[model samples]
Target chain A: MERKNFLRTFALVAATGPMIIDGCKKDSATKSTTSTTGTTTSTTTSASSGCVVTPTETEGPYPYVGGEATNPLNRVDVTDGQTGVPLSITFLVVNTNDNCNVVSDARVDIWHCNKDGYYSGYANQPGLLGSKSYVGETWLRGYELSDSNGAAKFTTIYPGWYGGRATHIHIEVYVNSVMKKTSQVTFLETISDVVHVSTLYAAHGVNPVRNASDSVFGDSATDLANEIMTLVGSVSAGYAGTYTIGLAL
Target chain B: MYKAKIKLVYKQVIDASSETSFEKAIIHASYQEFLLKSQAYNAEGKFKTFSRMKANDGRANSLHYKLSFSVLHFIEQLDNKIPVIKDNLGNKLSFDTAAFELIESHIEDSSLHKVAINYQTETLTLIDFMGDYLLLTSADAKSNEPSETFVVKMQPGLSIMNYQEINQFAINNLQLETP
Candidate 1:
């Protein structure tokens, strides 16, 4: 499925509160999604042009895009039933048109492949996910609604690689149900290398493709990096980082 | 007009014999529920109905989609006339729904409406029947082929993919809800 074809107009019905993006405390999470009725309307304010909201990439194939349910730990931790080193991901939702200040009430849904390069809730997947699909499994996926400072914190393992894309997490930030932006975040090549070579992701044949080799990242290296997270931890004791998403809306 | 969201409801016909595929029925019903909830259609393929079934005004209600259905034989007998859950493409997975159970079921007696089923072990939510699209297809003789065949109705002409991930997500967390 082309990234451009993944629709972004579904409702974001995750947890939301108010918090600072940079000062996201441990265990803080803000989940987001849109309402079903809102899907018919284009909530994304971006055109393929120079819209300041984060680049609108394809929604990928395995997003729980339309789900309104929240896991008990979806807010702060998504590694409930999976195995891997720990990772704490934090995101800050901001209105780019409004001087890039924090925007509260913004929802963010993040999903990535399990340590084995597989995604939950999918079947007959390509690469290592195998021919047998594992639909409805919500491991390594969660929701976070930014607090007053526009911050959402999630706890899970670092992402594994797939056939085409590098190690990355699919992030969608929405203002209520209207998706203000859809983009992705990745670790630095070296950092991801440590992740791919780890016991959790190595034996399963994680994608060997680097960021530069990834078709999407290669075409939009600078754009994708604009939203790359700033990390401050090791791949062993678990890593923690924060990302600020700029949306025109 | 806001299209009514297809609400999926599954009443636990806890059979002591557990002879048939009651558990599988929930999972199967869930797959069909996801299809109806995720993909909707009209003859023109351009129109939509947003007015989905409303369960209650609870924190749980707005967080997840609807899930409702009966045992497999009963559903199959409906002949797809009603919007029951199914794989759509006939891609029955090799995984078993009996491996799962509604470990945590929050029973809200305020009304026989709000229903939340969760896997007792994990943080995943199975089926949240907070009353959306309760009566999707009436038991009428309306002879419009089941919505599953309405592939052309997909706006982008995209096919509703398999339910492996969504189904597995719930199944992995499923447990046999003991009576």
Candidate 2:
């Protein structure tokens, strides 16, 4: 998808977060379908302008540590029995050096917290539900090598919010055993409002930290524009998100 | 918002099974777990380990006769130009040559088989083959231990690539045992 499309989608969601929350306070029961349909474009456009190198974001305290060496969980379904809003995340890795051509065989490592904001493979994760340590647990963590189309897809649930950071999924791309990119894919609060306030995710309430309040994504407009995932689908049926990442390698 | 700065603290590791050798059997089991779950081989391809022996060093039967050489040889082959361990602050631990050489030589000279990890001090553990040798205590102690046995039976006609089966077949059928 084009970068402009993602930016437009982000802007729409940026406005919808407050609207959805305010409506909920007044019991308006506004349908999210009206806003969701606005961002769904019919035409597919070239992403040549989106070819600029993806901004380097923090690897966050919970990286796999060994890149692809230690992580053996190569599966697409990283849910690992945890329940939440299903998210199908697709990362299109392109080369900034080579006219934005797709780069195949790049190793992509992904990890995020569950609906309760608990990350696996950590000893301590304190949050709203409770303080629990998931040391050695590999749920919501896996690695996938990019295919012929430079696409590495993962089947995971929509990650919940943590204390300081926004709702985001951590991503690291390695080409030829070298880390080409380390960044994150953030979700729009409009979508988070629908998913977080649902029956499954209602306990956590609404994630107060939107993209603008996030430590990593809050840095700049271009940061969210470059890192925000373009999500399609809904709160009830689940969402499929596509993000284009440009690597200099 | 402030970044949640979490440093690495060493977790306890223990032997998971008595019957299974830590080297091949356990590694293969984990490799199979990856293959079965992912349905795709690693980008580096199938799990493999290589060992080399010098003529006078082994004398054919010694248990620990310079494993450091082979370990260092593998380390030198890594094409990674940068450190893999990256935290929020971007301070990293690179697996450069000099550090491994020092650690290997120190271990060999001191005649110590195991290294102690201080839980109090934050340390970023380097990605060594040793991580595969032991299961972590709390999280993996239950499932990863082979003695506690859970079966992952392959479904009939599942389109998994036959490379692993073919390799196993070669090992079992084509071997000439020396009496």
Give the best candidate by TM-score. 2
- Chain B TM-scores, listed for every candidate in order, come to 0.18, 0.19
lDDT of 1 at B67: 32
Best by lDDT: 2
Lowest lDDT 10-mer window, candidate 1 chain A? A8-17
DockQ of each: 0.03, 0.01
lDDT of each model, Cα atoms only?
0.48, 0.52
After TM-score superposition, the amount by which residue B54's alpha carbon in candidate 2 deviates from its true location, in angstroms, is: 34
Candidate 1: misplaced stretches above 4 Å? A1-74, A204-206, B1-95, B98-179
How would you encode candidate 1's per-residue C-alpha lDDT over B108-155 as one tens digit per residue?
A: 111122222221111111122223311122211122234221111122
User: What residue pairs are clashing in model 2?
Assistant: none
Give one digit per residue, the lDDT tens place, for model 2 in B59-169: 311212112211222222222222232223443322212111111111112221221111221212211113222111111211222432111112221111211112333
